[model samples]
Target: MRRDRIAAIVGIAESDIGVTPDKTVLQLQAQAAVRALTDAGLHTRDVQALFCAGAWTTWTNLMLAEYLGIQPIYTDSTNIGGSSFEAHVGHAVAGIQAGLFEVALIVYGSTQRSQRLRGKVPGEVSLTEQYEAPFGLPVPVGAYAMAAMRHMYEYGTRPEQLAEVAVAARQWAMQNPRAFARDPLSVEDVLASRMICEPLHLYDCCLVTDGGGAIVVTSERVARQCRHKPIWVLGHAETHTHHTLLSMPDVTSTGAAVTGPRAMAMAGIRHDDVDVAEIYDSFTITVIVTLEALGFCQQGEGGAFVSGGRIAPGGSFPMNTNGGGLSYCHPGMYGIFLLIEAALQLRGDAGMRQVPNAQIALVHGTGVQLSSSATVVLGRD
Candidate 1:
């Protein structure tokens, strides 16, 4: 692939996040779409392509297109769990690069918190259910816990090292007013918190919150007309290994090991070039394992790398500046918020929580407990 920027994110927004009981999933999507389009200084009529995904409905893209009242030339609703939206960014970039569309809108929303739908098992009846569901492994958390256990046994990862991930996220959340659990958190607090699945505590797990987020992508020509500086989509890749934990080739590793390097190679950059990162923190172990897979540190060194507040607000490598799914709004699918916050930092619009001189941002998303991975390298010119 050519190293030139194929597409740029022009606008980003979040709609009524954190316990939005009054809003339906579609309403939340519409709100985010409108706000994002407004932020881009564009109108609904300008959206030439539409992309969306959610747990509420399978026909999310069709419904969102109708709701937004636009007949886009291109559409996609590729749902590969929480990393769906990050993959959507890659899809939009390809469409724009191929001259299929000029303006692409990606949106996501969920009411899992309001509907009391937490801990629900995967809806389909398949081999995944037959192999893992019979043991009553708590849908996603159990899978992550098993991975954490393997990481601990193999690398000697300690409880405090895992707790450090939660504490660091909370430290960043305290600075973000929109974060759901902004209360002060510490390593001791994480350790003391009730353990949901063995090894993974309540604090280590991500919050179940109602939220919506949006991003606007366009070609370099269209980006110049938008409201904010163009956050270029320099490189991207998505891949999945398994849907069930048992099928995963290595619980201690993820597909990120493949996607991360591929994305950076495509972007023509080095690991040191990333000024900021928005890594998916579905669980503390997810961050630890992913950091290693993404080549941020040597394999199994994730524990020490994230220790001593290394990824906190003022840390050498500022990450998840919007508090991440662990502290900020998760909304079931957290990939969209990763893009939203990355764009904010690249545009220099992330107040208080901004990473100073953040020129390049790397956004990574994990789906369904180490099942899928998507990495995007973004930068501002």
Candidate 2:
């Protein structure tokens, strides 16, 4: 009934995530795509499908397919804010199951920090303008700031609780050489940092970075011959609770509340089976809210769940081992990084950051003030 699904993530690659002043967006995408193809031990001619996403750049599937010198039997250019990459994975899976393509490549690149590309203005009233942009909120930090303030008022979530997320992420980053923010931080450090919005300090937010990442997916039969073991996509789902933070019924919970169970059920996995988690951390509050919605803890226990050394390196749950968006490079949309980290861990390629016997992983992406949500269950075959 599930269409006898067979997909394998054979390759993963990324450029330096923090500051890439030397390369164009296309160059970055090409580099990651090439690296992924090499990792899979496949040539460019083997690809039959292509998918891409971005805001300021014209990321066309055809252009990439042509650049890579492959004739795609199918192509997708779905762009849904920050959740685009995660959504792309679902679309690729559906396309593969429908017999539309045998192999598909998903790629994303951004130059926001280096190129200084200002995304579509929040207030610009075009058909493409986001509804929330009409209000004074333009950037993601402002929208998330509103939610953080509400959590503080309603659940008595403290600044230290928020700071704890940053602190834990930084500690993990120190162990990851590719992580951009390896510096140690404290609650006092976060509190003393510059204020982007009330109750949301600079350290509470993610970094604006320039980078790219890509992954290759193919039928399970073809994956057996690849260079590495396939990280199977056991289950995946995407949902939207609200298009804007203002319309959210409750900012405390996320669309993950709806999507998480569906994905896990599809995979026939329980919460206890997940050995690693790569939850997106666009803002400190984002991770806290997702933890609760994903059933890591009770509705309002996110503060206490992360209070002790639980999410740290040697804690009960080792999260964001490559550092999350909180400590890793956030090149505009950071969802792709989560997928890369999850796949690497399942493949046991995470080196010193590797969790012991990581057999299953849960990777989540939060896009546009928790407007769009995606969840994926990955397991080792």
Candidate 3:
């Protein structure tokens, strides 16, 4: 028997994406919050809990509550990197189940691209920085490159396989008008693109664009009165094995190995039941490694799994239908966008790139240094 859903995403929306020089991060978040609330046919006054995560601004949840003119009874600003928003969905569900709150707003916004802060030096140096700064390993790309190198050595994963990920993401982007880089892309094109880190080319990396998104989670009873069909939160889980690349248990693996099975068990769904997926593509290697960890394919088989356009539009397994971070707008944290896309796909609201009969969606996020992961299983009734 299918487990009863305790909460559902009632509304979802994205702020002005790509480039928004005029809007502040808070403004972007507020825009998304209002739009999402409006989409739900609810107002700020109805929000009982607020959830947010962002390093661009301090006190994100507090600032958002004040900006939206709401005094939420509960607030969470969990900063587990890009996966924070996915974790928030689980948190919201727990709060609702505990009868602590009814309406929860989860929001995220970033101006990383506009402010040219994608790789800026942090004001404070940490333990990870102390060990990594001297080596000149570019914050995240270098870490991913190291993992790619290891995966290649152990699994004989080829560079072309990695390029296939970029190619497939671009193929989906071509179908999404909101995608940032929708131009025709090919495997050859990805291989020929400028190299950012070893093995990972420019095309293999996710776009650094300004974007923001929000989602409203509420009890099933409250969701029934919303503007759209409630996309039920079937299951969710998150975990992190390390805070730095140096501390990672294994470069070829991610936290998804632990979270995937747990979340799936909670949702009571098998891998074949997922109609669509929105896995974070911070880098091409990120997707390959994550898919392996998520058990979509056996370890080291991610290369073969993603090749032959298997994950592209009209393929055996449709994924990242919104173009993903590789082609879509990837602000500092891409987790919130993952949830937003999953909710849209589950709602059957995606227009040109909508996956047919997308009843169950698997949304996964990889955080900084591939150290953290969060997975959520969503379904339509």
lDDT of 3 by residue, 1-381 (tens): 456979999989999999999999989999999999999999989999999999876877777788889898999998889999999999999999999999999999999888988776655677557777766778788899999999999999999999999889998899889999989999899889999989899998999999899999999999999989999999999998998688998999999999899889999999999999999899999999999999999999999999998999999999988899999889989999998989998888899989998999999988999988999999999
Query: Which should have the higher TM-score, number 1 or number 2?
Result: 1
The sequence of per-residue lDDT tens digits that candidate 2 reaches over residues 232-292 is: 8888889887765667899889988877888888888888888999998999999899999
Candidates sorted by lDDT, best first:
3, 1, 2
- Whichever of 2 and 3 has more TM-score, that candidate is 3
- For residues 263-370, what per-residue lDDT tens digits would candidate 1 score against the true structure? 999998899999999999999999999999999999999999999879997899899898999998888989999999999999898898989889899999999868
Error of 2 at 202 (Å): 0.6
TM-score of each: 0.98, 0.95, 0.98
Candidate 2 clash figure, as a count: 0
Alpha carbon deviation, residue 93, candidate 3 (Å)? 0.4
- Candidate 3 segments exceeding 4 Å error: none
Candidate 3 overall lDDT versus native: 0.91
* Residue 16 local lDDT, model 1: 96
**Model 2 error, position 140 (Å):** 0.8
